[model samples]
Target: MHIAEGFLPPAHAIAWGVASAPFVVHGVRSLTREVREHPESTLLLGASGAFTFVLSALKLPSVTGSCSHPTGTGLGAILFRPPIMAVLGTITLLFQALLLAHGGLTTLGANVFSMAIVGPWAGYGVYRLLRRWDVPLMVTVFFGAFVADLSTYCVTSVQLALAFPDPGSGFLGALGKFGSIFAVTQIPLAVSEGLLTVIVMRLLVQSSRGELTRLGVLLTKSATAAAKSGAVAR
Candidate 1:
């Protein structure tokens, strides 16, 4: 979700920037180490960033001068981890703001927190939790994408509510209003993105099982092979 420029108060904007700085720094270090250890993943990283860029760029207007779109953080977070997703996501946001003008530079920090840091962490957490529960791989992937997309909008609603509270209802009321607006569009988009992510994950498992395995996208080589074998059978 893109928060338009000059929408946030100076204090709020600067505060978000300050809060997001450490995450970006940490993400850079984490991504650097991951690349060093697995040079082959560089292409995968680029692909993930591209996916994010394309999906997030399709913004639809929503309440409080914000917009709704798929965060597309789930696949990357599931494959590369949240820290690396944060770095990649920031880069995607930067390009979208600068080149596409879909988002703005002044509000980059707020956008990063919602779309990059929080969304990835939420999706990755849900994925890991569901996997621990022994859920099916496709189900896990679907929920990861769905939850991540919704979580990004949820965080964006909060940011808007905090920035522009309702006169009579205050932050809670404003949050509910903004959230309802986003939910109307974001829910279907989240579901669509979840399905798309499952398809992409299956394709990766089929054509690039080795890469998914190396990234630990599939927990075991045997599982990856089994998935491929099943696809072949189908």
Candidate 2:
């Protein structure tokens, strides 16, 4: 979700920008380290950025000065972690603001906080938890995407509510209103994104198993062999 220009009060905007600066720096460092450590990840990282750009660019009108859409940060976070997603997601948001005239430049920090930072962390957390519990691959992927998309909107709702709370009902009421508006459109979009991500992951698994294994999403040869042996013994 993109909060249009001038929607947030200057104070709120500035505060968010200040808050996001450290994360952005950390993300840049993380990405830089990734490039140096694993040059082979260059292609996958580029593809991840492109995916984020494409998915986020497709917008749907929501409440005033804002919109709902599928955030592709989850997939990247699952593959590359939230720190890397933060960098790529900010770049994607920046491009959408400048080139497509979709989001706004002034609100980039707020947008990046909600979509890039919060969304990816939430999704990646869910994914890791599920993976630890031995959830099915497809199921984990779907939930990761779904949770990431939903979490982004939730953070957006909070940001909007904080910036423009209802006078009579106050912040909680405003949050509820904004959340409701997003839920109408966002619920279905999250599910769609989840399913679509699963498909994409399946394709990647088939075409780039080596990369997936490198990313630790797929079992290595020894692990697979061990798993098969354990299954046979069981």
Candidate 3:
């Protein structure tokens, strides 16, 4: 969900900008390494972003608006890297706002922080954590997409609350309002995203030529790929 300008007070914008700064820096660094290490994957990276842009912008009927869309957080994190995904998303949102006006220009940073930066990072983090616990691939994907969507909505809701503190929309209330408005649409979409992410991840992991190539975990070609394959098998 793109937060329009005036959706949040100026203070909210500043606060989010400050919070997003570190992620931007870290993302840039991570992307640089990814490009350096896997030059062959840059095309794949761009394609991943295109997939996200299309999925996110496709008009899915929703109570709020058909504008409601799914982010490719899980897909990106599963295949590439989360930081790279953030940058890809930032580009997608920027262009979408400029050409389609799906979101506001002035609020680009704010929107980026909520949807591109925050959502993907949270999804990636949770996915990694669950992986450590031997969680199933399908379950991990579902949870990642679910968390990413909710996190974006939470940020959007909080921004709205900041704008109209008296909308009487506390965090939970805002969450309820936003969730209710989109739940019927989001629930099914999330399941779809999760399935898509899992299938893609499974495909990539299985087809990887080297051990380290598995799971995009950046390990030595043999050991890492073997480790990843073993994990996936479990």
Candidate 4:
């Protein structure tokens, strides 16, 4: 979800910008280190950024002053980790704001905070947790992408609610209203994104197995066997 230009109060906008600055700075450092250490990953990194840009640019009209779309952050988070995804996500958002007018400059921090910082971290958390539990790789991937997509909208709703709380019912009521409006389209969109992520992962597994394995996405044969056994035992 992208909040329209100037939709948020100046105070809230500045506050969100202040809140999001550190993560973006850290992300830049992380990305630089990644590219320096593993020059081979540069191509994949660009692909990840492109994926986020293309998917997020397909904005669907949803709540007023905002729209719903696939975040396309989870795949990068899974492959490159959340820190790297943060950099890619920020770049994607910046380009979209400038070129497509999907999001606004004023709201960039808020959007990056929700989609780049929180979404990737949240999705990667789920992915790691599920992997540790010996869940099927594709299944874990699907849920990870699903969470990442949905969480962005959830955070957007929270931001909106905080900025424009209902006069009579207050922050919680406003949160409920915004959350409900977003859910009307976001839920199914999340599921679709999850499935699409799985398909892309499948392709990567076939064509770029080495890279996927290097990224720790595709387990070694021994590890896969062990994980399968662990799942069976459970």
Model 4, stretches more than 4 Å misplaced? 60-67, 222-234
Q: Which regions of candidate 2 fall more than 4 Å away from where they truly are?
A: 60-67, 224-234
lDDT digits (tens) for residues 1-234 of candidate 4: 788888988888888899888988988998999899989999999988888877786666554545568999999999999988988998888987888887789999899899999999999999999999878999999999999999998999999999999999999999999888775568877887899899988888888998898888988899889878888898
Q: Which residue pairs overlap in candidate 3's backbone?
A: 211-221, 211-224, 211-225, 212-221, 212-225
Candidate 1 lDDT over residue span 104-196, tens digit each? 788899999998999999999999999867699999999999998999889889999999999999999999998887755688788878998
| lDDT of all predictions | 0.86, 0.87, 0.69, 0.88
lDDT of 3 by residue, 1-234 (tens): 687755656777677767766777778788889889878777667767877876787656655454467776666755665777777778888888888877776677787887777778788788788867868666776788667765765666666655554456466676566656555456656666666666665665676545324444434558757878998898
Q: Please rank every candidate by lDDT, starting with the best.
A: 4, 2, 1, 3
List model 2 lDDT by residue over 49-103, tens digit each. Answer: 9888778866755434456678888889988999999999999988888887766
Pairs in clash, predicted candidate 1: none
Best candidate, lDDT-wise?
4
**Against the true structure, what is each candidate's TM-score?**
0.89, 0.91, 0.79, 0.91
- Please give the range of 10 consecutive residues that has the lowest summed lDDT in model 2: 59-68
- Tell me the TM-score of model 4: 0.91
Q: What is the Cα-based TM-score of model 3?
A: 0.79
RMSD per prediction, one decimal? 5.4, 3.4, 4.2, 3.0
Task: Give the winner by lDDT: 1 or 3.
Answer: 1
Error of model 2, residue 222, in angstroms: 3.4
Model 2 quality (TM-score): 0.91
